[model samples]
Target: MKELMDFNFWEMILRTTLAFAALLILARILGKKQLSQLTFFHYITGITFGSIAAEMAGQTDVPFMDALIALVWWAMLTLMLSYISLKSSKFRVIIDDEPSIVIRNGVILDKSLKKARLHMDDVMMMLREQSIFSIQDVHYAVLETNGELSVMKKAAQQEPTKTDVNAPITEPIYMPSEIISDGKLVVKNMRELKLTEEWVMKKLKKKQINSIDEVFYAQIQTDGSLFVDKKSKE
Candidate 1:
């Protein structure tokens, strides 16, 4: 009882609070990433941050300020690398790595699988998750930087739509391109769609939207129709 009473309880409390606060602030500063979207680098960084915070909270011999400084240093280094990666494609490739084409034109690339450190069973499991039963159905299978598998089915295996069967002359169908998301303009997508800011503003005006900030999302359909969703009050 005496030993328990003599323990620096107040100091421990203060250290814990400071460490937790630092963790929250750093997490916010680092920005949001979904668990499914976490890359290898992100996973390692998360573990390191948690370990540092735990040490600061539990270890009394180490100064709190020193631990805090270490935590901040790691975060700053990560941010600097992220900035450099954004500016230089080569740096980004070196850090985050490029996507690998594991399967092309219904043929699996053994070299790519070996380079990605993935086995046949792993690829098969990913294919099953994508609703593909056989490798013959796959036209292209790209292993993304985030470790997600993107599979494209072969044309022969794809189901024909109503237009394909009924129309005398069929036209290529285009996927809807997003031009705005979370009240921010997607300039690259707008350029790809061959749309101007003036045109977007005119469309918004027709929808009684005064500013781009009022929109939650906006997309351009294949038929040249503009779909707009206003930000909800909730």
Candidate 2:
């Protein structure tokens, strides 16, 4: 029993306990953003802590002072990074994902939506919730980091902008672009435009689009039209 509770064993236990306490303290100080704001740096920090804590806790024969020193080092590094993000815009960008404009001129920016991992349906739903029944009403839309959509309506749609205008109105045309379907091109859509693969090839060639693999999304409208967005754009 005495041999089991030797200096090394006691030291290791003490170190483990102290390290755990320090980690708990730091977690509390960092607050809930550690979970809510899951940025690149936060992910890295979490993985580092988990790995080191596990290894250090298992080292039953290591000196308590050694574990304590390591814990302090990690804690200080994490706190420093957090402080840098709070104070520096450059650092904040590195850690957190930035808001991107996903809709421009009433048309969804396919590349931006792809980069943000959002679908057109999701964006449209957000728009509907914002009291926008048609995409034409939106001048700009941003996908915020919190997964919320911020929208700016067209001047003619908003209250103040419409108050001064008394122009005649036209029928609302749904300008939905049938760009892609099931991760493949809609051949029917091509036929509707009286277009062929030849025309698509021509447009692709103009944009230096050498292969269909380059395109992740494409849209077509009631008008003879097509829009291809490259996977590499993101």
Candidate 3:
């Protein structure tokens, strides 16, 4: 009980809060790409950041400020590397890695697969996820740097969409706009679409939703229809 009520306990709490806040600010500065599109560098950086933060929070022997400085330095280095990669295509290819053509013109490139450190089973699994069960249907398949497979089916095997079928092209296709996500209003999206909060509220009211908090997600389709998913009571 005495150990729980010590000065070190309170000091640790303060250190943890400071560490977490610092990491959050650094992540925001580093950009959203760290979360959405994590490359090899991003993955390693994330792990390193977490380890450093943990040490800062829990290790009393090591100075908290020193750990924080190290974290900031690492994050800055990552940002610098990202900027350099963006400016130089050669650097980008070397650091981020180039996509490998694992399958070309319906033939599996075994050498490319080996170079990518991927196996036949892995390629087949990735293809199945893309709805291509048979390798014969694949015209081209590239193994992306992020380990995602980009597959193109044979011309004859491709499904015909409305455009391919020569259907009347009505209004220009617009991507759905996310107005609300996880009960939070996407103000940036709203601004981009030139929509007002009152407009979104009116749409919600029409659907018998009293509050924005009741919605889990709300998207406005290209055709001007509001699609809403309410929060489920689990």
Q: Which candidate leads in lDDT? A: 3
> In candidate 3, residue 191 scores what lDDT?
92
Error of 2 at 141 (Å): 5.5
**Least well predicted 10-residue stretch by lDDT in candidate 2:** 169-178
Measured over all alpha carbons after superposition, the RMSD of each candidate to the real structure, in angstroms, is 6.9, 13.8, 13.2
Q: Whose TM-score is higher: candidate 1's or candidate 2's? A: 1
lDDT at position 39, candidate 2: 60
lDDT of 1 by residue, 79-185 (tens): 88878876665677798887788997789999999999999999999999978989999877889898999876765666678866753542223236678877878
Candidate 3 residue-wise lDDT, 43-79, digit = tens: 8788888899999988988898899999999999989
**Which pairs clash inside model 1?**
none
By TM-score, the better pick of 1 and 3 is 3
Clashes of 3: 0
- Model 1 spans with C-alpha error above 4 angstroms: 1-7, 34-37, 156-234
Candidate lDDT scores, in order, read: 0.82, 0.69, 0.84
Query: Where does model 3 exceed 4 Å of error?
Result: 1-4, 166-234
Better of 1 and 3 by lDDT: 3
Over 4 Å off in model 2, which ranges? 1-16, 35-37, 61-64, 104-106, 117-141, 146-234
> RMSD of candidate 3 to the true fold?
13.2
